[model samples]
Structure formats: C-alpha cells, structure tokens
Target chain A: MVDLILGWTGVVLVFIGVFFLFLGALGIFRLPDLFNRLQAGTKATTLGVVSTTIGVGLIAKGWLVFSLALAIFLLMTNPISSHALGRASYRAGVKPYKGTNPDLYAEKVKKESDQK
Target chain B: MRIEIPQFIWIAWFVIVSIATILATIRAIVGPTNSDRAVGLDTWTTITTGFWVILALYFFQYILLSVSMVYAILSFLGVLAIARYLERGL
Candidate 1:
C-alpha cells in the first residue's frame, strides 16, 4: 500500500513538474525582453526540473542511485548556471529596464570602494 | 504480472519535452545576441540531457545510462566554450 501511494504521488509530482517547465519555456519565448525572459525562464526551470527529477528518482527504485546523484547535481548546478549566464549577460552589455535603471553591480562596487 | 505505463501518457510526455525543445530552438533562433542564444542553447541541451536519463529509467535499461555520461561531458564543454567566447570575443 505504501509503495503504491508513493508511486501515485511521484506521478502527480512529475506531472506538476512538467507544467512548471512549460511555464518556464513560455517565459522564455513570451517575455518582452532578454532580462525578463532570463529571469522567468531560469528561475522556473531550476526548481521545476529539479522537482521532477527527484520524483523520477523516487519512481525508478533502488538500483539507479547514480541517477539520483545526477539529479542532485542538477539541482545544485542549475542555479549556478543561471548566475553565470546573468553575469555574462551583464558583462556583454545587456542593459536592465531598457537602460533606464541604475546598475546594481556598479553601485555595489562603488559602495565597497568608499568604505575602504 | 508486469506493469506498464499507458502508451498515451508516455507519448504525451514525449510531446511535452519536444515542445520544450522547439521553444528552446525558437529562443536560439530569434535571440538578439550571441549570449542570449548561448543561454537558450545551454538550457536546451540540459533539458534534452535530462530527457535521456528519464528514458533510460523508464525502459529500465542500464546501458542507456551511458547517454548520461556523454551528456555530462558535452554540458561542460557547452558552458566552457560559451564562457570563453563571451570573455574574449571569439
């Protein structure tokens, strides 16, 4: 009975995971600008995919422990990848809010310099 | 008795993943710059890589796990190459 319940739970979780993933992709295509799209796409997918992956790990049973490790690795790496992408985007000169907003990174650097 | 997933559900998952792949393609194609496309492509490859692992698990095929290894290597290369190009203007 427990196994069956877990399996059903896993299925539902995976289905929900898929839905969020679709939202992530839609954010990528439908958002107005690169900044908005990246924020929407990256944030949704990091959590969505990791959640689905864990559900898959649960359903796949005991022998595929490596698969579980990989899923955990993905959970760790997705955020890092997004951080790297954001930094790269900023360095490449993609301005925020169509260049109207102040640059946060530059402001932080200025504040740190003044403190020293 | 052996258990099986409904064929329609399996096919539905495939279609959903494929739609995601297509959307990623759209991002890559319509991207305003190289970095934008690179981000899209990176996520696309990662998702496809995850799909491979899911298929392996669904089939209970141990050999198919090797695909994950290949994906790991390629993922690192994708990120490294893109970062390098972005840094030095390749």
Candidate 2:
C-alpha cells in the first residue's frame, strides 16, 4: 500500500514538472526578446527540474539521496546562472522588450558609468 | 525493484519532453541575436537535465542518476562560463 501511494504521488509530480518544462520551452521559442525569454526559461525550467528530480527520487526509493542532492544543487545554481546571463546580455546591449517601462537597470548603469 | 508505471504514461512523458526539446532547439538555431541564442541554450540545458532524470527512472538505472547529477553540475558551469564570456571578455 505504501509503495502504491508513493508511486502515484511521484507520477503526479512528474506530470506537473513536465508541464512546466513544456511551458518553459514554449516561452523560450515564442517570447519577444532576450530578457523575456530568459525570464520564462529560467523560472519555469528551475521549477520543472526541481519537481522532476524529487519525483524521481520518490519513485525510486534507493535513489532518493542523490536525486534530492541534485535537485537542491539545481535550485541553488539555476538562478545564479540566469542572473549572470541576463546581466551580461544587458551589458552587451541587447535591449529588452519595448513594453518594458521601468528601465531601472539602464538608469543604474548610466549612473555607474557617469560616476566612473 | 522497479515500480510498475503504465507504459502509456511513460510514452506520453517522453513525447511531450521531446517536443519541448525540439522547440528550444529551433529557438537556438534561428534566434535573432546572440543573447537570444544563449537564452535558448540555457533553457535547453535545463530541460535536458530533467530529461536525464526521467530517463534514469524509465530505465531503472541507478547509475544514470549519478550521470544526470554530473551533467547538471557541468551544464551549470558551462552556462556560467558562457555568461561571463558574453559580459566582457573570456
């Protein structure tokens, strides 16, 4: 009974993860600009991978330790990489979507350049 | 001992993820700018990590779990390096 419950729970979690993964891909493909794509790609894929890894861990009882560790490592590193990428892209002069109105990062960059 | 997941369920999972992978690849190939390509690559790596985990479960291979973990670490480092290279100089 316990095994049966865990298996079903894992299946459900895996389904959720795959759905988010699909969304991330769709966003990466269909989004208008670099920053928009990065936003969609990073957030959705991070959640998707975390869920998928943990679900796999639950399904395979013996592999739980390593899967959990992978999931944790991904959760920590995915954001840092995405942040670095976004900063780099902006610095490299890839403009955001035209709808982006805040323009705060550009302002901050301008101030820093002026200070220098 | 492998848990008995239905075969159709496995097929469905694989098919969806495969489609997602293809879409991301298309973005990477035809992206308008370098940063757009980088975003596509980033998404692709992440999806591949998840796919590796699913494959490990499907094959019931404990060793593949380790392989996926290593892949995750390497991909993370690769993405970071790419980002740094894009920022100024390598």
Candidate 3:
C-alpha cells in the first residue's frame, strides 16, 4: 500500500515537472529577446528539473537522498548561471527589445566605465 | 506480485522531453545573437538533466544518478565559461 501511494505521488510530480520543462522550451523558442528568453528558460527549468529529480527519488525509494542532493545543487546553480549570462550579454552590447523601459543597467555600466 | 509504474508513463515522458529538446535545439540554431544561443544551450542542459534522471529511474540504475549529477556540474561550468567568453572575448 505504501509503495503504491509513493509511486502515484511521484508519477504526478514527474508529469508536472515535464509540463514545465516543455513550457520553458516553448518560451525559449518564442520569446522576443535574449533577456526575455533567459528569464523564461531559467525560472521555469529550474523549477521543472528540481521537481523532476525529487519525483524520481521518490519513485526509486533508495535513491531519494541522491536525487535530493541533485535538486539542491540545481536550485543553487541555475540562477547564478542565468545572472552571469544576463550580465555578460548586457556588457557585450546585446540590445534589449524595443520599448524596454528604464535601461538602468546601461546607465550603471556607463557610470562604472566613467569611474574607471 | 510487485506493482510497477505503467509502461505508458515512460513513453509519455520520452515523447514530451524529446519535443522539448528539439525546440531548444531549434532556438540554439536560429538565435540571432550569441547570447540567444547561450540561453538556448542553458535551457537544453537543464532539460537534459531532467531527462537523465528519468532515464536513471527507467533503467533502475543507481549509478546513472551519479552520472547525471556530474553532468549537471559540468554543464554549469560550461555555461559560466561561455558567459565569460561572451563578455570579454576569449
């Protein structure tokens, strides 16, 4: 009974994760600009993969600890990598989409360059 | 008798993830700028990590879990390298 319960719970979680993974891919394919794509891809996939890993752990019973560790690692690194990519792209002069307001990062970059 | 997860569940997972992979690849190939390609690559790697976990469960292989973990670390480092290269021109 317990095993059946865990199995069904895991199945539901895995399905949810897979759905989000597909959504992230769709966003990457359809989004207008690099920043928008990064925003969509990073946030969605981070949640998707983490959930999937944990679900896999639950299904396998003995493998839960390892899966948990992988989920935690993903949660830590995905955002940092996305942030680095965004900053690098901005610094490299990838223009934001037209009508993007504020442009605060560009101003900050300009100020830093002036200081140096 | 030992109950098992239905076989169709695995099939469904394979189909969905494959589609996701293809979509990401298309973006990577067609992206206008290097950063766009990097974003595609990043999404692809994350999706693949989830795929690997699913594969491990499907095969009931404990060792594959470790392999996926290592893959995750390597992909993270690779993305950081790409970002650095893009920023400064390596």
Candidate 4:
C-alpha cells in the first residue's frame, strides 16, 4: 500500500517539476531583458529542481538523504547566484528594458558618491 | 505485479526536459549580452541537475545523486566567478 502511494506521488511531483522547468525556459525566451530573464530563471528553476529532487527521493526510497542534500544546496545557491549575476550586470551597465522607471540604484549610488 | 506508471512518467519527463534544454541552448546562443548567456547557462545547469536525479532513479543507483550535488556546487561557483569577473574587470 505504501509503495503504491509513494509511486504515484513521485510520478505527479516529477511531472510538476518538469513543467516548471519548461516554464522557466520559456520565460528566459519570452522576457524582454536580462533582469527579467534572471528573475524567471532563478525562481522557477529553483522550485523545479527542489520538486524534482523530492520526487526522486520518494521514488527511490533509499536515496532520500542525497536527494534532500541536493535540494538544500539548490535552495541555498540559486538565489544568491542570481543576485550576484543581476548585480554584476547592473553595475556593468545593462540597462533595463526601455520605458522603465527612474534608475533608483543609480541615483542612490550617485548620492553616495557625492556625499563621499 | 509491477505497475508501469513510473516508467511512463519518467519518459514524459525526459521529453519535457529535452525540450527545455533546447530552449536554454537557444537563449545561450542568441543572447545579446554576457549576462543573458550567464542566465541561460545557469538555467541549463539546474535543469541538468534534475535530469541527473531522474536518471539516478531510473537506474537505481544512489551514487549519481551525490554526483548531481557536486555538479550543482561547481556550477554555482562557475557562475559566481563569472559574475565577479564581469563586475570587477568589465
């Protein structure tokens, strides 16, 4: 009984994971600029990876420990890396897509520089 | 009796992941800026990690799970290094 339940749950979770990944990839393609693409890729792909790990854990019961470790590492690094990439890109002068709001970061940096 | 649902689901997931990989590859190739390519590569790495997990489950090998974990760490560092380089040197 437990095996059957776990088997089905695993199947569903894997499907959801794959679909989320597909959506992330789609977002990378459809979004207009670098920041938007980074946002989409980081958020969606992180969730997809965690879901897939958990699903694989359920399917392969003995490997749950490693699966959980993979999920934890992914949760830890995905956002930090995305932030680093976005910050680097911003500092490197990749402008936001046209018609965006005032550059608050730029203004703040300028003010800091002036004060210094 | 063994059910075949797991096999079917794995096959379906493989198909979806393949499509996603192709999409990421396109983004990486066509990216106008370095950051765009970095984002695409990061997405590709995460997807590949999931693929490794699925393959581990399919093959009933526990070691490959740790392999994916290590892969994730290295990929994270690679992106971080690229980000730092882009920020400081470019």
Q: Of the candidates shown, which would achieve the greatest DockQ relative to the real structure? A: 2
Per-candidate local distance difference test: 0.68, 0.90, 0.91, 0.86
- Over 4 Å off, model 3: B1-3
Clashing pairs in 1: none
Residue A25 deviation, candidate 3, in Å?
0.5
Query: Cα deviation in Å at residue A29, candidate 2?
Result: 1.3
lDDT of model number 2: 0.90
Best by lDDT: 3
* Residue B76 local lDDT, model 1: 52
- DockQ comparisons of all candidates to the true complex: 0.42, 0.85, 0.76, 0.70
- iRMSD per prediction, in order: 2.4, 0.9, 1.5, 1.7
Question: Candidate 3, after superposition: displacement of residue A101 in Å?
Answer: 0.7
Better by TM-score, candidate 2 or 1: 2
Rate residue A97 of model 3 by lDDT: 95
TM-score of model 2 vs. true structure:
0.96
lDDT of 3 by residue, B46-80 (tens): 99999999999888889999999998998899999
CAPRI-style quality class for the chain A–B interface of candidate 3: medium
Better of 3 and 4 by lDDT: 3
* Deviation of model 2 at A30, angstroms: 1.6
